[model samples]
Target: MTNAHHLQNNKPQDIAINDDWFDVLKISDYLFAISEPRHYEHTVVYLLLGSDRAILIDTGCGIGNLRRVVEQLTSFPITVVNTHTHLDHLGSNHQFSEIMMFDHPRSRDLSSNGASRDLLHWELHREELVIPPWPRDFHIAESALPPFKVSRWLKHDDVLEIADIRFRVLHTPGEAPDHMCLLDQTHRILFSGDILLNGPVWSHLDGGDVGELRDSYERLMRRVNEFDVVMPSHNTPCQNKDLLPLELAASNDVLSGKAQPQVGTDLWGRRYNKYDFGRISILSKYPQ
Candidate 1:
């Protein structure tokens, strides 16, 4: 992965938030990577600015005031877009009003009912996973994700025009049924959700399908040349496009049974076969 070209310190000193819970890295004049580095998930959300509006792609774990941090960054109207409805990604969705999500049953269910407290127990209670100095207002025991209304349901290939910039939505399910990636052809960037990350990609969860995950990688590989940089949602923020083929190869190996996997258990105590591939790994359910 190449080093991120962060904005200069003098660029906008007034926009910087004094909070330590979130690490905001300026990737470009119009893009910012907002992340919760203190948590185990290291969930990274992105903010893309345009002439008329700004798009916040996925809200990181609701451990802090993301809305306040975002409001300090841009003055344009904001739109929240969930790459998928995973709790870690949409934790702060309720904090935003103009929200957009991919039209899927899982997305609808989670959006309406909200995630239960049980779903967050692993992250909240795991003392070993948390770093020191959590946000003063964040109560681990009482924190729970709230339901948010989706203002628009997006479809595959739909073009989102935020004034001068545009993002083409690609429905790339596998990490979740509602998983999607945004492709900015003009900017040469791919906002890959959980599908392609620097660490282990989980396809062993309840709503995930290893087979479908492999297919999604194949679909992205077909148009790999379209984007030069990959802005993943977890672990690393900005990565070279070279990581795409590596992930695709790992997915293919897992499906073909050519890769040997080690047994592992998640926070929920469900067993999964973890296939390690150096920088990237694939976690899938054991074959019956």
Candidate 2:
């Protein structure tokens, strides 16, 4: 509410989504994400109030102009993070100057290209993009959000203390080694990054691992009783207070064995399928 530009100007058109809290079309005070018809048109970055300041998860491709949108929303310093360093997620990193990344071999090892080539292709063509992403730039671009810095490298079990909130980092590697989830026990909310341990949730086809993903899902399910809401970086959030238990149960079965997957669908008409594979071989079986 303290942001200098609040209500003073209009938010960027490309990055704005209709607010859907309680189904009311009001601008969400907690977070806002813009979508381009690319990268599966995955929702990017969740803005929320922390114990101390505002926190932003995954700066979707700079194409969405996420920083500009957040700038008008809050005066608090934004803590930029990532689900993983794929182009769609990390496009806006260079803008903040000091962005944060988890300390994992895949995350830390940025030898020029910054992101691994294989993962880059996968996150992009997860069955062709829908978000209408910006024109491809061959050269890797650093953050362009500006007026900030990037100096946070999170670790497993690490805790982040913002102005008044505390977030526990769970290094649940699946989509990428640097992947993590933020547990806000106080609010019973888990900001699930790519560690979305669910039906076909693991993208083993894109540098994802079956074994690590299973472990991540298992770890989360064991702690499911502690949280009530899952605000995933992509896809719709599950605010059902009683849904965690169901998600947890299904998660356990998937970890120990394969699921029949009675039926499931992602927001974008993405249908789920069933599959079986060894552990690095973890992959999704999507219905074409």
Candidate 3:
């Protein structure tokens, strides 16, 4: 694993952000997001500078001149990664023939959650749905696009060194069963996918299990000391890595039946509301 010699000794720095047409964050040798504008959509993309080539985390929604935005950055051999199959995480998937995701059985299906389907034609800037139930159709043109190489599926504790940027992958199951977070040990940064957002936690209970989310959070906290900075896919850059513990305290309040479903601003400058359907149901099952 070759580390970029220049990014060393970064003592907890607020990621350099620029709002020049595109929302950006310079995290070490990688870039967090170039901007994706949907409230629930994540605009996180990473420009991993590698020894030989480079890799991008997720393609910004192919819309909004992302093609032009990336070109302004670098022109290395770019490989795209979708934290999962959510439409927001895969807007520009069709743009790249060589993309990858968790090789789970469900990975083959290009469909997404109900909310995502509510965003069909969103990439085309045509989110107008005449019918009340029509908007729940947002997702990729799975059939229209080319086949992807589901060659690599990371497991917990797996380390991926791409674009010369090293990441310790944590298989976080909630939000998306195949979601993974990236960690930069040198700076103790945790590239929390959609798992640790700074806003209201989405209790997407439909197929999501709250118990599992609780477990994942515990696992994440166990390793919180491993990372001092957390770079979430959405919202603002990591301000303090200690937020992990703070979040844990809040979560415990909810888990212990002390708090109600809360809506608040989370990491990444964006505000989020995590009151997904299954939230109440999951919380009800807890011994609280």
Off by over 4 Å in 3: 1-21, 27-32, 37-42, 111-119, 122-147, 262-288
> Candidate 1 lDDT (Cα, whole model)?
0.84
Q: lDDT for every model?
A: 0.84, 0.54, 0.54
Model 3 scores what on Cα lDDT?
A: 0.54
1 or 3: which has the higher TM-score?
Answer: 1
Q: What TM-score quantifies how close candidate 3 is to the native fold?
A: 0.69
Q: Best-fitting candidate, measured by lDDT? A: 1
Q: What is the lDDT of residue 98 in candidate 1?
A: 95
* Model 1 weakest lDDT span, ten residues long: 1-10
Candidate 2 local distance difference test against the native: 0.54
For candidate 2, write residues 149-173 as lDDT tens digits: 3487788888777666667888877
Local accuracy of candidate 1 as per-residue lDDT tens digits, 152-254: 9999889987667777899998778899999876676889999888998988887888788888888888778778778899997888778888988898898
The TM-score of predicted model 2 comes to 0.66
TM-score of every prediction relative to native: 0.91, 0.66, 0.69
* Full candidate order by TM-score, most accurate first: 1, 3, 2
Candidate 3 worst ten-residue window by lDDT: 279-288
What clash count goes with each model?
0, 32, 23
